[model samples]
Target: MIDYRKATVPVWTLATGDVRVPALAGDGPMTAERLAELRSVLAALADEPIATLEVHPLPEKLDSGRGIPLDAASPLAQHLSQLITQSARSSSTAAKATAAGEGLYRMVVPAKVAAQLGQGIVRPMAAKGAAGGIRGAFVNSTTGRIAAGATFVPAGQAAAAGAVGGAGATAGVAVGGSAALTVAAPLVLMAIAVGMSAHADSKRQQAIEHITELLEQLHEQKLEDEHSELDGCRDAIDKATAILLDQGKLGVSLGLDSAVHAINTALGAADRRLARWQSALDKLPDGEAVEIGTLTKSFPGVDDHGGTFRTHLELAALAIALKRRVNVLQAVEHAQSDPGNLFESFVRALKRDQQRLDELESSIAGVLERLSALELARPNGLRPVFTTGEVDRLMSAAHRIRKLGDGVSANSRTTDLAIEIARDKDGSVVVFPALPASA
Candidate 1:
C-alpha cells in the first residue's frame, strides 16, 4: 500500500534576489476566519486547473526517445472525435455506419421517469451521479478522458535550476500534467519560511494561494499512492464494456419504443470514465512533464538547515487554521446552477464532456485520508491547522458527491445500469453468471 500519510503539502517563499525558497505557514493552523477565506479558492479548485504562478516543474523527457508527449496533440485527438459525434447524431448515415461506437448515444428511460428525474426526484442513492455534474463537465466530448489534477521539495538537497520549489531538490515524478518536488531537511526549511511570512506584510491572497497549493499537492500525492487502485478500477470498466459489446455483437433487441436521446446520452457517458482512467494509466510509464511526491509539509519546529526556526510544525501544528468562516462558499458553487434539479443539471452540463469526476472525488478522499492519518498517528498532535471551516465544509461538500453511503443504496445506480440491458421478462432483474475469472 502506498503510504499517503507520509507526505505533506509544500509551502514556499519568494526569497531575496528574486529566488524562491520553500515556505511555511507563518500563521498557525487556519482559524475559522482564515478557513472562511478559502471558500472561493476551494470552489475554484473543484472546477478549474491549478493556478501556478510560473512554469515551475520544468518538463523532462522519454528515455526511449520515441515517446509521444502527453500534452501534445496526439493525446487530444481522441477527445475531439467524441464531440463531433454528438452534434451529428440525427444523420442516419453516421448512425448506421457505427451502431455501437459512433453517433449520439443516450439512455432511454420512460418519459415519466425522465420528468421525475428532471424535477430532482431521483430515487435513493441516485445522488451518486449528481456528483458527476461538475466533474463530468471536465470530460472531453471526444475522448471522454478526465483532466482532473495535484505538488513539493526538501532542504540541503539542491534543486533543478527551474524546479517548482526552492533551491535544494530531487528529481520529480510526473503523474499526468502535474508534478512533485522533493527537498532536504524539510523541518528546518519550513520553520524559516513560516515565521518570515508572519511579518504583517503578507497579503490575504497569498494565504489563499497557500491552501490552493496544498489542495493541488494533496491531489498529486493521492495519485502516487492510489495508482494501482485506479488502474484496477479502469480495468474493471474495460471488462464490463467488453461484455456489453460482446452482447451487442450478437444483435440483442435494439428497437425499443423510447426516446433515443436519453438512452444513448447516458450510455455514451456511462463508461466514459473507463476510457478516461485507461488513458491516464497508459501514461504511467512516462512520468515526465509532471512529477509526484514533491510536496514537503512544514511546522513551527526544527530541520536540516539549522535548529528549528521559530516553532515546531508537525501533525500537532499547522500553517493556516481555517474556522469554516467561508462555509458559504461551497454553496455558491451549487447555487449558481439549477435550483432543484441536481441530477438533470449534471447530465446536461456533462453530456458533452469527457470523464473527470472520479479524479476530483479521489482528490477529496486523499485529503481526508491524510487528515485521518494525522489524527490516528498522533492524537492531539498539532496537525496543520485549518482555522477556517474550509476542510469541514469541503468534507461535507465532497461527501455530497463522493458517495451515497454503504451497501445497496450506494450501488443502486450501478444496479440500474445493469438492468438497463439485462432485465428478465418477469419484471424482476436477472443476474448473469460471472464471465470466466480470467476475463
Candidate 2:
C-alpha cells in the first residue's frame, strides 16, 4: 500500500546493520546518521541480558508528516528524561557525545550492576560544567541496571564529547520507512529479534505451519494489492501502506482503515468461541478435571468426546493471535512472562490484554479521529494519505485470514491453508508492506 521510494527509513542501529559513517560528532544538528552511531555504541557495551534504549530530544512545536515528533512524546520520553537527569548527576562520567550524539543509547541491566558502575548515564556527555543545555538523560529504576554509559566517557574528554552537545536539542527530525513515531532505538529492534527467538521448542512444528500459511496469505494479498478491483482503491492502499511503513511503529498491518477494529472484533469472537468450548467442557465428565496434556484422550464410545478434542485443537490453532498480543505486552514491560502459562495465565492476561487493546485501538483511532476532527488541519500529508476503501481492504484481508482460522472461527476449510496457519505461530497472515514474491 505504500510507496517506498517517497518515504525515508529510520536510522538502523549497528546491530541491525546500520551503515557506518565517519564520526561527525559536531558541525551539524542531530541528524538520523548520528543517532545511528550513538545507538550502535551503546549496543556494543551490553549486548546480552541487557536492554538498550535510545533517547531523542525534539525541539518545541516541530511536526513531521510522519508521526515522529509525537512518538517521541510517548511515556518513554518522560521516563528517559528522568533517567538521564539522574544518571548525569550521579555519574562523574557519561558519554562524551555532543548534541549530534543525541541518539545516545542506555543499556538496561540488574540494579547491582548499575550501582557498581556508579550512576551510569545515557545523556549527551558535555563536561560537568561544559556549555550547552542537556540533550537528554535517563536514570535506571532501582531494578533495571543502567550500565556502560559512564564508562564510555574518559577522564578528560567531556568537552570534545560535548561538542555537538548544543545540537542535542535540535529540532530537525525525520523518520524512515514505517518508523512513524514509536521508539526507533536499536534496543527495541534487538528486543524484537530476541523475543521472536523465544518461541517454545514444543511449538516449533506449529510455528512452521503458521509461517508457511502466513507466507502464502501474504503473497496472495500482495498480488491483490498490486491488482486491486478499483485503481482508486489500489492507489489509496499504496499511500496508506507508505504511511504505515514510514511510521515504522506498527509492522505488517492489513492496509485497512478499520483494520484494528476488525482485529479487535475477531479477538472478541475468539473469546466468545472459547467460552463455548468451555461450556462443552463442562458437559464432559472429566473435561475441566483433565489437565492440558490429556485434552485429546478420548473415552470409550463417548461420541461427544471427539468434539471436545477438536476444541482443544481449535484453541491450539488460535494461539498465534494470543501469542502475538502477549509478545507486544512483554516488549513494553521489558520482561518475559512464562510461556507455559499462556492458557492458564490467559484469564489473568485477559484484563491486561483488554486494557492494552483499548489503548492501541484508541491510539490508532485517534489518527483517524483527529483527521476527521480537524476537517482541514492535515499536517505531514496524512489527509490524502488515508482512504476508506483501504480501510475496507484491510478489514477484508483480516477477515479472510480469520476465515483461514488459527484458533477458532465459524468457517471451516479443508485445504492446507486451514491446517497450516491454524497450527503455526511464526506470525499472522497479515502483511505490513506486503511480502516479497519468495515469501
Candidate 3:
C-alpha cells in the first residue's frame, strides 16, 4: 500500500535570463526517468544557455510552487547540468561542421577543456553557432548546449590565417567572435520572445481572476436579495394573519360563533399559502436561474412547487366552504324564531337554501381533497377555479339565503304586535255583569 500522505515531491524552476517559467511540482522522489522527461522538454526549446533556475525541496503541506525560491543543491540542478552539457557538445559540433564554408578542415578540441568551460553558458554558444554559420562554435561551461546563434568567422578563413600567428591564436579569435554573437544578438532576440510570452500569460491569468471574483459577487448579492424578499413575504403573511384574528375576535364579541369559525378557516388557508411560499423559495437554487420548466418536466410534477401552490388553493377553498356554511347556519337560526304564514313560507325556502349550501360545501371539500392529493404527489400552484361568473353565482345564492332569513324575522314581529293589540281592545270593552260575585 502506498501511503500517499507520507510521500512528497519537490518543485523545480527552469529559468532563462530574467523571465522565469512556471515551476513544476509533483509527487514522489526524483528518478532518472523523470529527469529524462524534463530533459526532453528542455531539448524542444530552440534557444540555448537555458538555465534550470533552481530546484527546491518544497514544504510538505504547500502544493503551490508560487513565491517559493529555488534551491541550488537539489537533484534537478544536477540533472539539468548534465543534459545542458550533452546538448551543447552535440549542437556545437553540428554548428561548426555546417558553417565550414567552401571547404572543410578537421577541427579537434580537447574534450576535457570543453567540459571545463561548463554547461550553462556553452550550450547557448553552440546553438548560436548553428544559427549564425557553420564554424567552430563557442560553448557555455555552465549549460552544455550550443549558443543560440554563433558569430564565428568561417573555419576555412581561420585555417588560412594560421601563418599570421599560430593555429591557437586564429582559433581563439574565431571562438571569441562566436561567443560575442551568442551573448549579444541571439540573447537579445530570445529575451524579447520570452517577455512577450510572459506578458500574454499574465493577461490571461488576470482575466480568469476577474471572472471568478465577479461570479462570487453575483452569488452574494443574490443571497442578500432573497433574504430581503423572504422578510417582506413574512410581513405580508403576518398582516393577513392579524386581520383574520381581529375578525374572529369581533365575531366572538357579537356572539356569532359561526362567523368566528369562518374567520378561523380563512386564517388557516392563509397559513397554508405562507407555507407554500416558504417551500417554493426553499426548493429554488440560491442563484437567479431557477429552472421551473425543467423541474415540472421531470418526476411527473408531483413533488415540486406546483403541488405547493395547489395546496394553498385547497386551503383557500376550505375558507370559502366555511363561509357558505356560516351563511346557512345564520338563516336556519332566524327561521326557527318565526310563527306567521309568511314566516313559515320563508322557513321552507331557507331549508332549500341550506341544502344548496351543504352541496356547495361538499363540492368544495371534494375539490380541496383532490387538490391536496395532487399537491402531495407533485406540488403545483392552483389553477383559478372561480371566474367572475362563478363568484356572481355564489353571491346570488348567499343573497337569497339572507333575504329569506330577513322575511321570517319581519313576519314574526308583525304577528306578535297584532296579538297584543287584540288583547288590549277586548279589555277596554264595557262589562254588564260586573260585581255579580259580591251580590
Candidate 4:
C-alpha cells in the first residue's frame, strides 16, 4: 500500500464545444500544467516499443505520505504488493533496488533489448497515446459543458488502450463525480504518469538514478553469466596443455607443439584485455552525480559516458572469441582420426562452447539491431549516445569466431586442424589442419 493525495480537480464532466481533453490528464492528483508538460514527453516516446511496466515503491520516502495512493482494495494494488513482496525475497533484487525516490519506475523490455536499453541510455519514449483522451476528459469535465451523456473514456481504460492496447488489464472501472477518480487498474495510470513524469529536470535526474542502479545490476548479471564459461575455458586449456606436455614426454610428436604456444598466446591476450578493463573501471569517478534524499552511493565507479562500461562488457564477449580460438588448438592429432577419449571430450566441449557462443552472438546482434533502430528513429540532433565501437568490435569478433567454430569439422583429416593453421579455398587462414605424419 502507498501513502496518498486526493485530487481537487473534477473527476467526470461533460465535454463542451470543441474543447477536448489532452489525453494525459488522468483524474488523479496531477495538475493541468504537469499534464501539458507530459504531452511533450509522450510525443517523444513515439518510437519506444515498451514491453512492460514494473512498479517499485519508495518505502523510505513514503514517510512524507504524498502521491496518489493506489486503491488497497483493488486487485491491481494487491498484485503490485505481491510482486514487491516477491522482489523483497530476492537478494539480488534487494541489492539492486537502490531507488531513493517516492517510486522507481521501470520499463521492462524483452530480455534481448535490455542488453543496451537498460544501460542508462536516454529515456524511453513516453506512451503518448496512453495519455491521450484521459487528460482531455479531465479538462473538459471542469468546463461545465453538457454534451448529454457523451461518455468520457475512463482514465484506466484510456491509458490501457493507448499504452499497451489493453493486453494486461484485469478489469476496468469508472469513477463518477467531482472527487478524485478511483482507478480500477492503477498500474496503467501509474505507467502513464511515470512516462510523462520524466520530462521535468528533477524527475529526469531521479530516472537516471534508477537507471544507474539498473546498469550496475546488469554488470553483476553479465559477470555471473560469463563466470562458468570463462572457468570452463581456462580448465580446458589447462587440461589440454597438460595432455600435450605429457604426449611430448612420451616422445609422441603429433605436430601439436605449436598448439600450446597458440593457446597461451590467445589466453594472454584475453587476460590483458580483462586487466585493462578492470583498470579502466577503477579509474572512473566513484562519486554520485547527484544525491537524492539520503541515498548517496548510487552507481559507484560507473562510467556515465559508457566507455569504461563498454570495456567491461567487451571482455566477456572477447573471452568467448578467445575461447573459440583456443578450442581450435584442442582439435589436433586424433581429433579427426580414431577419436580418442581426450579428443572426444575436446570435441564435445568445443561443440557446447560453440553453441553457447552462438547464443551470445545472437543476443549481441539483437542489441545492436535495437540500438540501430533507436538511432534511425530519432533525429540526428537528438540521437542517444553510446560507446558502439566496443559493441561493433565484439560483433565482428563474434562473427569471425562463429565462422571458425562452424569450420571446425570432425570429418577433417587428422593431418590438419579445422579451425586454426588452415586455409580456405580463397587462401584465407581457415581450413582443417593436418596433424604431423610423425605421430
Each candidate: RMSD to true structure?
A: 28.8, 23.8, 46.4, 28.5
1 versus 4: better TM-score goes to: 4
Q: Model 1, range 1-439, lDDT digits (tens) per residue?
A: 1121232212211111121222222323233223223322322332211111010111122121111111112111122122213312433333332333411111112222222212111222111344432111112333333221211121111121322122122212212211111111111111111111111012112333333444343444432332222222222222322322122221123322122232233233323433443344344444332111111122111111111211111100111111010111111222224334322333344222212322333332343233222211111226766545645544443343222122112221311110011111121211111111001
Residue 279, model 1, lDDT: 46
lDDT of each: 0.22, 0.27, 0.26, 0.29
What is the C-alpha local distance difference test score of candidate 4? Answer: 0.29
lDDT of 4 by residue, 9-124 (tens): 11211110112223444434344344324433432332222222222332232211112222343322343333333333432333233223123333222222222211111122
- lDDT of candidate model 1 versus the reference: 0.22
Worst 10 residues of 2 by lDDT: 415-424
TM-score of 4: 0.21
Point out the higher-scoring one by lDDT: 1 or 3: 3
Per-prediction TM-score, please? Answer: 0.16, 0.25, 0.17, 0.21
lDDT score, residue 129, model 4?
A: 51
In terms of lDDT, which candidate is stronger, 1 or 2?
2
Q: Highest lDDT: which candidate?
A: 4
C-alpha lDDT of residue 167 in model 4: 18
Pick the TM-score winner: 2
Give per-residue lDDT, candidate 4, residue 177: 23
How would you encode candidate 2's per-residue C-alpha lDDT over 1-439 as one tens digit per residue?
1222232222212112122233323222243334435434443443221222332222222222211121222222332333333334323332222123243232222222222211101111221232422111221223222221222221111111110111111111112211111122322222221222121111323433443444343345532331222122223333332332222233345343343343344445445544554454445553123222222232111112223323233233333333333333333323213322222232243334444433332332332222122111112344757577755644443343233222221121111000000000121111111000011
For model 4, the stretches where C-alpha displacement exceeds 4 angstroms are 1-308, 329-349, 375-439
